[model samples]
Target: MTGDVRGTGDGRERRNTEIVLTAMRELFHEKDLTALDRYWAEPYTQHSPRMASGLAMLRAAVPTLVGFSWEARRTAAQGDLVFTHSLVHGWGPGPVVIVDVFRLEGGRIVEHWDVVQDHVPAAETASGNPMV
Candidate 1:
């Protein structure tokens, strides 16, 4: 109620977006899910095909991965929604690109959605005559 109440909701939503992404980046690289309890609402529902809907499942399954690092490329927010595009690098299965969307309520992440795409190998250049 202090600073620009009209835009406050949108501003907080955007701020929460960055906060959530930062937390996720830290978790992905460090494998520390402790921030989830602090940043996410209870019974947070993530619309990921690979992750279960509850925090317990996340705590149990995330560490099973060999290595995972998520680097966020961009973020945009409107109303209470935040959209992010990111690239994930690691040595486990392979590199991946992830696009994520988050919905925040009262500055807390309430729901999440993401799509993961495997990084494609670069095309080989054709060189009829090899030059050193």
Candidate 2:
């Protein structure tokens, strides 16, 4: 995935966003839940209905992610906010398309919001474009 970070200020914030997202991908793909502490804040706020608000809750849910595969399709950043569009295969009955937005403070992810939709077969879509 490619991300274009633009701003007149130094690229520190953009870099930080990239770092956090990269760590997130690693945590999911590698199943290294402990790595969350390095990229996320202690009292993380979760906006996803399925998840509780806290880093510990995320850690506890790691085991269920074992068979899932997360692939980042694109990323974008502005100021302290970073957004990612990704796909999660083997998550449920079919692959899911997910868009996640993260808020960062002091280089740590403090808040998150996400939207998930199940991938539809090409035959079911009017445009026939793949979801991811």
Best by lDDT: 2
Residue pairs with backbone overlap in model 2? none
lDDT of 2 at 118: 92
User: Model 2 off-target regions past 4 Å?
Assistant: 1-10
lDDT of each: 0.67, 0.78
lDDT tens digits by residue: candidate 2, 10-66: 686668657766777667778787679788886789999988999888788776775
Model number with the top TM-score: 2
Among all windows of 10 consecutive residues in model 1, the one with the lowest summed lDDT is 1-10
lDDT of 1 at 41: 79
Query: How displaced is residue 125 in candidate 1, in Å?
Result: 13
User: Could you tell me every candidate's TM-score relative to the true structure?
Assistant: 0.75, 0.86
